[model samples]
Target chain A: MEILALFGDFTVRTVAIGAALVGAVAGVLGSFALLRQQSLLGDTLSHAALPGICLGFLIAGSRRLEPILAGALVTGAAAALLVLLLTRTTRIKSDAALGVSLSLFFAFGTVLLTYVQRHAGAAQAGLDAFLFGQAAALVPRDLVVLAVVGGGSLLVVALGWKELKITTFDADFARSLGRPVVLIEFLLTVLIALAVVIGLQLVGVILMVALVIAPAAAARQWARRLEGMVVLAAVFGATSGVVGALVSASIRGLSTGPVIVLVASAIVVASLLLAPERGALWQLAHAFAQRRSLRAHRVLVDLYRLAQDHDDLDYASEQGMLDTYFGRRTGHVLRRLERRGLVSRAHHMPEEGTHWVLTVDGRQQARELIRPFGERDTTLDGATQ
Target chain B: MTGLQGWLDQPGVTIVLVGALVGVAASLLGAFLVLRRESMLSDAISHSVLIGIVLAYLITGALDTPLHVVGAALAGLLTVWLTDVLVRSRRVKSDAAIGLVFPALFAVAVLLINVYARDVHLDTDAVLLGEIGFAWLDVVRVGPLEVARSLVTMLVITLVNLAFVVFLYKELKLATFDGMLATALGFRPGLVGYALLALVSVTAVGAFDAVGAILFVAFVIVPPTAAYLVTDRLWRMLVLGCVVAVGSSIGGYALAVAYDVSIGGAMASATGAFLLLALIVGKHGIVARALRRRAPRPPPVVHVPEAGGAP
Candidate 1:
């Protein structure tokens, strides 16, 4: 099969690959994103890209990737600058500054998009596609561009790993050590913007933020170390891309971006439910299993009473009475009791059936579960069951 | 017919009324949006609701007036729900969760619009603009008002939203200020949150046709932001937001008419201008107080004594 034909060669696939690569790289970087508590900055900058993309398209007059990306970079940087300005100039905190900048730039972007749509009709055809992306229109060239940008994003992260980690965990400390805190921060913003632009062609303006944040979030549940989290995030991001692409291929008229989000959501849900110690389901199951074992130990203690009370500690003595006392499930409970050697059936009592009794070890096991319930002396006065 | 005739009968008044109405509604919700620190939620919900509209069309095969609105509500709710799920379960932060959910949903909506919506009477332009001008072109009679059905829809939504905020004021305030305290009091922050989300959904639906989804962010944020400059109390904030919104609406329409520009854009620009003005020139404006107070002068005699000693 032709390599292209086998892949169902289309812009959609190419663009989908671009989207996946963008997601993977961003997810890795986003470990730092989440750690810094600036997860929403992705959303802010992505929206901030709108006006730039519009301006780029307005001047450049084509869907060519490079100019639009440059336009996005300028706007994203401006938005970040405004946020920084807001934080420094006022008593308002970082979140407020972020909120203010996010809304203002996005509003400007909307105005730009609407204005261009109405006025620059011939020059600005297909502009709205950038707003939400036109992944299906991806070409080989677009894929190459994404790969380069995506690779560059990875390189930036790897090269600045020590500096990035230092700044993320403690900017003050890094600054105290006379590190280039401002420069590193600016560099991080540019790299994030680069990730946003790489994703723009496929994931579009609104959802590209999601691509950056989701995998990192899921990876966090599984890893204690930051490096481990970043690696896991990249893996999850790549996997989401693959599954999303396959689903899009299998289904006609299905959009790639939403499917990708759904796939990432699945990964998150799986991690939340299944990851050891932290997962909700695992903890719930562990607690339930512990309770059931405790109850089983209690039932064995009741058998200890039946056999040890009679001093036969054998199957034939008072076996019918023990069965009646233990209820209908007594036979089943008795089997477990015998397995533990808390009870046994004697050869002489084969006709008599099973006898329930506690071995010395079994008696010890019974005491362990009952110990936390308080001693018999403490329980007698309360008279509570 | 009655609704259209009424609207056309007062075309100039209608534009201002529509603009003001959009402003008021957007600003009302904008307060909670700003307070909850989800001001950007407005932007997210408005853009993402296109997914709902397209999905509605796909499911029902008609972008009939009410269905389109309903679809928007559904889509808006879906965006919120997905955001919540991502943030809570995936350990994804709220902003990223919001970012992830809507774009994907919006992309799906746009994709549907691209492939299937062509013959189905769904154009992207109409989706964005929401036929603000055409609202007068079609109408339905309601009791005595003879209002444009769009206005009627918005009015009903506005009233319901007002009622919701009024009744749930205490709960919303408590939750907004201190969610843990609200939970400790057994006031059910979850229920309050649901109510707020529901209000956002309804407002999005109501505003969808009149202002379009993208512009909805302006209304949802601008007024509240401006209001924040003027007041610290929640009720006061809400009042101020509504006032700013209404003022911007009328002012924007007049400006648009004067300049022959897009009414929605003008309205949003006006609101933005008001926010900037409030930030700079309001009572607490940085420039205002800095200019009012001056710093003390340094001692000039000390320098002369040092010079004499050197001589």
Candidate 2:
């Protein structure tokens, strides 16, 4: 096949659909994983899938996607089981458990890979592509396998949604409520393994964890509910997958997994910056505007205090005196209040400098800040002037 | 007699030695990492070290220099620093920070190898998969004896790591178990922690030449974790970790030779087998618990009061 044949419309379509399916399934399951704080478990499961892929190839003596993915599911789930057992039974911490499983299984898989490479000879040419993944290798049959597995995992998630959610947030409470927490936890883990296996061909085992976590992590920025996070994650995952697969297909010598991971990471970056409520930039701007309002409130209250002390409602306090009182410049604060029609700037007669007086609206706001329902709003007093 | 002699000859001794030394060095450092809950940071450092090696080569135009080691160490620290920054930003969770930094750095390294260093020895296979099978081919001489370069490198590292543990035994122990107490006692626990991480990074660079990054992680984590199951004492854990590492190296080499598979990988898999073995047969293992449960207890001596009797 010519290299250009990789870019053929049909091939591109198949690859995109395959990647999207992988991404959506992983994203939905990954939301539960992330919420449960088992996000890194996805990384462990992917690393552990290599030996299974090699074993599957050895058992089938061909590149059949069905056997390959099935093999991945088995070992991946076994790795998760080992991790759970280790953490539950022994003194091993969760992070150590994750690392032990990921590395040992991956190493074991490399052994099988090499064994297959040496013994199977030329027939094993494309097998190592599973290392970094090659989307151009996707045939129509592979796509069918991906869809069946991906769709089945999603269906299981939908049917077991309530149990999964209950276990995720509070396993102890779920157990108290007579839910089979252990069984539910196991089911979720297995489902995550299946999602990871689904993504193995598109993103490969090396970087498949990013697909499992990135979409969910990104979606979490926009969502506060499990349902919304899951849905948004699925969408983000599918979009990144298709875009990455297409880019890899277009570029020569570029593998699919890294491209997809990079794209997914880019989405995470954008979401963290641009998401509405919880976005980093959004929060920063909100804090800044809040600080500005706080300062304006302080200046209004200060002007009110000065007028009352002089026994004149029209008393204008010089900016220099207010700065001395607040121990900082009040020009910017006064100007900001003037923009809001909260204060007016007047010329002090003796000194050629500006003085500030609160308008009627500013006085009312000041009264509320100082004597909120005749009770001090400590919220105003506590802030730095 | 001839079989033993043959096993001792050409590449066999060297391969096992190199694997064992790398395993030993990693486990010595890993005991602290596993205890400190920073095992994943080791994983992150191992992955990002690839970029350091590639960048070092690009600048120095040489592969056989200490610059690669230096570069790898710097890259490992960079991963740690970047993870810290991301977590501190409060936008990314600590776990996600680890997952994000290493893979991105690794991806960039792989892409760089694809674009610029394609013809060099820094291919994806050589860097990630490793070629410990050919370690014997490269030799350096000291005194009248010739040795595999990797073996020498790993030996120095293992001994240095041993020295580190021995010299700062109390400090590491204090920091691992009680950071606040150590801080109050005038031990700069944070500095000690960074020092330990730096050693782990250097050790990773040494082992990277033999077992690759993945297998090195297997060595670093599995043996130490298995040892944790077997013993509660730090000294005992350290020794048991080394024993597991060495045994795996020897056993794994035989398995590889018999099956024609990757030696480093088989060594790593052996460590996992030992962990499973520990899980089943150690003092705290399942069999002991099951036996204890089945064992008959002495009949309970009950102070029985007469029916309807009250004090």
Candidate 3:
């Protein structure tokens, strides 16, 4: 109750909301990134935004969020453009081009940051937090900025929905259909860059890739359709943001980004274990049930063979043999089988030790169970008909 | 002109030399990483080395030495191991696994530095940017000649890398080109992978002081990737990669001096520029071929009846 009350505090409440917005935006955009196999683009754009933020601070000369964010947006877009140019103009592969552009821009940003810190003496003027964000320090203005960026990104993505989806699924097809591939790709890249830049204010550059990759990855396992994937990815992202914010608010000195990543990680683990077909638990259970059915079929086949070879097999006498064959006690199970009317005691045998014989229904059930594993010609179904 | 001569003679020249040497070795190892489509792993390893550096400092009380290399190498290898573990045991995709491991490690390193090593200047800026400018300060004088320690170490690493690639060229090339084929040919692709990973780690460790962890990827990836566009044969690509790396290193230093920019950043940018130029102007450039090739035969004109008209 105390913790809940603490969480309700306005400081915690506002920050949590801001975190959620960031996650939601990232998740929605990240689904597109993952589907297109552009996972590392998140890392590239995040790093690329550093110089923008620095330049924003430099231009504005205050700890204000607006100019810094604007700087980040411009630089982020520029970096994406540079990467595109590299891919189109040069023979460099996308991955290599991404690496080159990312490192170069980021290193330049780091150098600027160092120079600012060293020469300006206003090093702690909210610039350092961009590298690894400090959620505890987020003010209401920061929240407002996050909202604007988040809402703006969402609006753009929503409007470009058809175009973005077409390009992502099949660029060639989109081109063939007269859709402007370059224009749509460029638009999507801008939206992606915007998402990355917004995330910088909350999670920072080092961990923003997690925001982009984890939720989308987790959502992919559960979703069969692309639309479902994007929606679920956003939900997972928002959940991680809220949960991570709560945990951070509860503890002193806990960075919000890492906690958010940890929360996202938890979601990934849960998805891996609980998703319908892809879940580990589902696979394990399926395998175990399969083995059980196989064993049961084997037991029935062996009993039928014994009955065929001899006049009858004593149920009580067979319990000992079943125990030896399967390495377990079978007397209780044998009684259950008798109750199910699948097997019966032989009248010729003594009452204390009853001999058993398969009923007509029991023989049919055994054949059904064993049919899948045997050769086609050996199947009993044709003979039965 | 005087400043240029002076700069060339100063120990800063040693920084460029060391940077170039490290660049060559890193790019050599980077070929396989790029081909295997694990280029980002270099970035992940580079970032995670901060934790290793900090831990090493705590344990050994040394700022930058062979011990630093050991710690960084261990950390890089651990990152690779952790990523693989996450991929195999936890069923996380490779990208997500890489994403998960590095930031966590980096955050721990940053927090540790903030809490314990604040007074000692043990921060990521130091670990990432390194003291390339100060490499001259720790010069080892041998009677008449003075050599930068970083340069000497990088030289040794460069030689080792050259030897490894030359002696095991066939195996390395075959394995990198096609792991399945290498395995079918009775070579353990896994061992080769480990060897390559270890080489990348060591190269990163050796280069950390001069170029730092962040820019190490630029060195490792840009050259080989650029070379890949121009050549098909592995041997030629290797040579071309080394040459491109060395050229970029020189150009980067000159550009940095001219523009008064970050030397490492400038070098990376130069390499990227070189790659772009190679990709565009080379004989196999997409635009060039598109221009040279004639259009295919025009599509057949099919007569279509108007909607709801003749069939």
* Best of the candidates, DockQ: 2
Model 3 lDDT tens row, A295-359 = 65666676765654454433223455667877986555556666778777665445445455677
Give the number of the best model, judged by TM-score: 2
Q: After superposition, how far is residue B166 of candidate 2 from its true place, in Å?
A: 1.0
| lDDT tens readout by residue for model 2, A17-126 | 89989889988998888777787899899999999999999999988888898899999988898888778776678999899989988998999999999998788888
Query: What would the TM-scores of all predictions be?
Result: 0.81, 0.91, 0.83
- By DockQ, the candidates rank as 2, 3, 1
> Could you give me the TM-score of model 1 versus the true structure?
0.81
Model 1: per-residue lDDT, tens digit, A147-177? 8888988998999999998998899999999
Model 2 chain A scores worst on lDDT over the 10 consecutive residues at: A376-385
Error of 2 at B9 (Å): 8.2
- lDDT of each residue in B1-311, candidate 3, tens digit only: 55544564586587688778988999888988888777888998888878888888888887876787778778888999989987896555676678767876776776677556777866555566666767667666545566777877888899988898888888888888888999999998888887777778778877777777778888888788777777777887788888888888888788767766667766766787777676676565555657666667578999888899955
Q: Looking at every candidate separately, what fraction of the true A–B Cα contacts under 8 Å does it contain?
A: 0.27, 0.64, 0.39
Better of 1 and 3 by DockQ: 3
Ranking by lDDT: 2, 3, 1
